[model samples]
Target: MTDQRANWTDEKDATWMTEMIYQVVVLGKRANSGFKKESWQAASSKLNIEHRVNYTKVQLKTRNAEMKKQYAQVSQMNSVLESQRSDACG
Candidate 1:
């Protein structure tokens, strides 16, 4: 059980986790913008095995929330930028 705080610093681990969560959702493990407990547990276990580090369901959930927030922010920024461009070009 190595330090999980260090696990996220590795880009490979972060990318793998993001992809794994997306795959889980695409596979229908997610419901109503949330994932089932077992789904999270499975993701955590798989990541731990693949990355050789310890991670918990809570960590995965937190990361998912953080990623969603970030994505929303980026989307909003892009939308605003597109609107500005439209106004300028109009």
Candidate 2:
């Protein structure tokens, strides 16, 4: 159990796992035609059958807003940490 815990807590291993998951999701989204399709014909065909385009658009916009907020928070965190490090070193 201690060995397993040590292995799981490895930073390099966690970073690799995070990168793998990100790559998988990025590739999967790229492979999805509905998200990438731009033609009215293709979009209409898919949305006409499913009536999900508007909802999906709304969801995407909401997600974009949330991501922006998260990015701002992370940037602020980095700024604070950098300032703290500078003050400590100085």
Candidate 3:
């Protein structure tokens, strides 16, 4: 095994730069958002489509509160996993 700091050198730097350039070119081609305006508009239209439902302010607040609670639970689980990983390694 080699020391972490000692493993880095000019060759590694050049390889990293080449990989980054390749990734950028590939991702740019895959992301057709700039060229496909009609497709983007269609997707947006689909996403923004809503049903006609009359909900009171209190009902909306209750739904928003439930969503926040679910989000916090997921975030806490992620944090626990991250801390466990750091503790196991170090």
Candidate 4:
């Protein structure tokens, strides 16, 4: 049986994974469509080995998608807020 702690990814782990993914994208491993199989494997391996976790590629991919969704939502909200502020000032 796998340890629960090993399976669990906390906030810090998620942030670390995000940073790694950004680095991967910066290095041209990720394209507009998404990560390729080799890139996924590389990111999964790096996270498992360096972060001492046991996340599979699917898990990492799912988490990345979730983070992207959250980021987009936040960005949209910020844009709306800024627009409202401009209207109020104008």
Which number leads on TM-score?
Answer: 1
The list of candidate 1 runs beyond 4 A from truth reads: 1-6, 9-27
Whole-model lDDT per candidate: 0.71, 0.43, 0.43, 0.69
Task: List clashing residue pairs in candidate 4.
Answer: none
lDDT of 1 by residue, 1-90 (tens): 433463465564565567566757577676676676667776777777777778766777677787789889999999999999999999
| Stretches of model 3 off by over 4 angstroms after superposition | 1-49
lDDT of 2 by residue, 28-72 (tens): 423353333232223233432443223243333344366569889
User: Residue 43 in model 3: shift from native, Å?
Assistant: 21
Using TM-score as the yardstick, the better of models 1 and 4 is 1
Q: Give candidate 1's error at residue 77 in angstroms.
A: 0.5
Structure candidate 3, residue pairs in collision: none
In candidate 2, the residue pairs with backbone N, CA or C atoms under 3 Å apart (3 or more residues apart, or in different chains) clash, namely none
Selected candidate, larger TM-score, 1 vs 3: 1
Q: Which candidate has the highest lDDT of all?
A: 1
Rank list by TM-score: 1, 4, 3, 2
* TM-score (C-alpha) between model 2 and the true structure: 0.41
Cα misplacement distance, residue 64 of candidate 4 (Å)? 0.5
Cα RMSD to the true fold for all candidates: 3.1, 14.6, 21.5, 3.7
| lDDT at 16, model 3 | 35
